[model samples]
Target: MNALVWYVIMKWMPKGSSCVDFVTQRSLYEVRKRPSKSYSWVAFMLANICAELPWNTLMSVFIFFGWYYPIGLYHNAEPTGAVTERGALLFLLIWSFVMFTSTFTHMIIASVDVAENGGNIATLQFSLTILFCGVLVSPSKLPGFWIFMYRVSPFTYLVDAMLSVSLANALAFCSSVEVSVFDPPSGQTCGQYLSACTSIAGGSLSDVNATSQCEFCAIMDTNAFLSQVNSYYDHRWRNFGLMWAYVAFNVCAALFPYWFGRVPKSAKKN
Candidate 1:
């Protein structure tokens, strides 16, 4: 089916330049440096790519999918769950793979910047690919993708960001790799609320089942405490891979220091 569609597009496109060639040429021409600073609009991406690998990966994934599915929204009460599920999967898989590819592009530039042949984007890309492989590739909600970003988290987003930055740092050291801090926010969680139970039965709201209520309340409190501590270490102990995962994160983050594409060729230098 895809082949057939491509065949039709190629057949219908104006001759002298086939569909493939047309796109290839256009990409090449557009990417070529110019006086207008046309690529500046995409400068955010280019600059971040040169700086932060994981972050760039996170942001790029959100942007690409957000464009592809502009209405990728999460309802307060997502009906049927199917809508949210589809949106999340699309966001995760598509975004991760696309961004996974971007890591290579970044590494190439990183090595060039540092004048090192071994320090290519491949490792950075690999780390991200592995990091997000199961999480995104597997069926999951988009909100779940960013549980780390949720304000409801016991800690503030700043703390979470610091935790991640730190974890990324640790990864760089253990793996003996240079990690770059380049990712910026690409998607948002929209709105969220965090309300603790202020009263028991009938004080402010309707009476509830004590057994169930206490059980849940206790659970929430425990999770809240652990998540807060996790904020300190970025939940490193959650998995054994953390030993090296943090190592990998720290590796790519070297370029950042501050803790913060597609195919096609180029036309020519302006």
Candidate 2:
């Protein structure tokens, strides 16, 4: 639930407000005029990108405090005595997420002739990321052909890292209703019957000596649950690094369309 909330918030946060409003508005007048007069498109793009950095950084700090503690994800690190380490990691990931959102919004908006068109494209792209980011649907459950989408989505790494940091190593105790009850074979104890399966799949067996009413908690720990969704605790930092690669990609990509298509050829000749 925390991961889902994070994903939804990050994905929709830029949608509710314009991240590149400053840049896009400049595109309407200042970007074209400056490029034609003395500035190169690259210069304009660089300035615009740099100009937004401080604000985005500030926003990330606000978002981290507002969302992280309220969601109670800090508890995940509490039991493991990794509160400081995990907290710092989560803050960095949230900061990266904010930077990605801003840069991605800038890229899409700059890549088009019309802001409306860019917005529509961005919406479509965001929707695809949401569908394939291993939240609404597990990557394991996605069909072979659509699996690439899961791999390509930036949200994939972001979500995986966030979930691992927030949920990994924690124990999951099933409520009475969540525990499964079944009978073991005629001569076997519950542990003897299900030991092989639990050894491989992970679960806790109750009443090891009983043949009837064998209880099991299918989700033993956060690690086991994360594995089922194709995420792992060990890969948390790796995924965080990967997510920044996407952010850098977005930052670079934001310059392309505006430079090639939006910039006037006459401006280049100047």
Candidate 3:
């Protein structure tokens, strides 16, 4: 599909120019021109951050109050309640950073694809994104080489951070019930100790005993549950820091392509 689109675009492109040349020239022109001194790149970045802040905060509040609050109440869980405020703040920060990084990273990728592959790299890019982002398999289960991809993907950090913020301290109560045979001690007084008590009094053990009580027990605690699923909060802050670092790295990466692609063909020959 991408090939067909590129073919059509190339076939009809302006007589003397290809898509790559056009994109490179346009991008270089934009970079070279001083649009406004008051509106610098730093100012643009700040504006993007500020613009995303309120939306991120609103989403965090909704998740905490609407989703977390009700679920905690339903389960009679109190651990999350204590840290809801802190967790929400962390969630907001991480989400905002991720949004910023993803936006510029995507821009960088698209720009590079246009300049190098005539934008035919979409399918490859999408596949790689999904593969490395833990969408197809969990990071812990990925093979050695693929594990590197998982580790490098920003999606992995986002997922880990979100899970840590939402479910780290949350408690889940799980119960199991079982029926067991009533066996008396070897020397105990059988008549004095009517050990078997059932709904049908004086009924035989083999008979239907609807009155027999089922034993219900708690299976595991919060830590056990988290460990079972390989979820942890110990590295949440670290992940957040890494995500922001990715944002910075992506911004630089996006700009690098523009610089690289802007070199004139004649200059390269000379």
Q: Could you tell me which 10 consecutive residues in candidate 2 have the lowest summed lDDT?
A: 11-20
Question: lDDT per residue, candidate 1, 55-133, as tens digits?
Answer: 6457656554544344323331144344454344434433333343343333343223232332333344344433332
lDDT order, best first, reads 2, 3, 1
Best by TM-score: 2
lDDT, candidate 2, 1-270, per-residue tens: 645655545554456246346445666555456745766667767776677778978877887788778878888888889988998898898888877777777778775656566677777887787778888888778899999999899888888888888888888888999999999889899999999998998899767788889999999888877787777888888988998899889877888777776666654563
Of candidates 3 and 2, the better by lDDT: 2
C-alpha RMSD of each candidate structure in angstroms: 20.2, 3.2, 12.1
TM-score rank order: 2, 3, 1
Model 3: lowest-lDDT 10 consecutive positions = 8-17
Global lDDT scores for all candidate models: 0.32, 0.78, 0.48
Candidate 3, 182-262: lDDT as tens digits: 444455433323435432232222323223332222222354444544446776777777777776776666555644664
Report the candidate with higher TM-score, 1 versus 2: 2
Q: Candidate 3 has what TM-score?
A: 0.54
Clashing pairs in 2: none
Best by lDDT: 2
Q: Which residues of candidate 3, in runs, are more than 4 Å off?
A: 1-77, 105-110, 113-130, 133-136, 175-219, 263-270
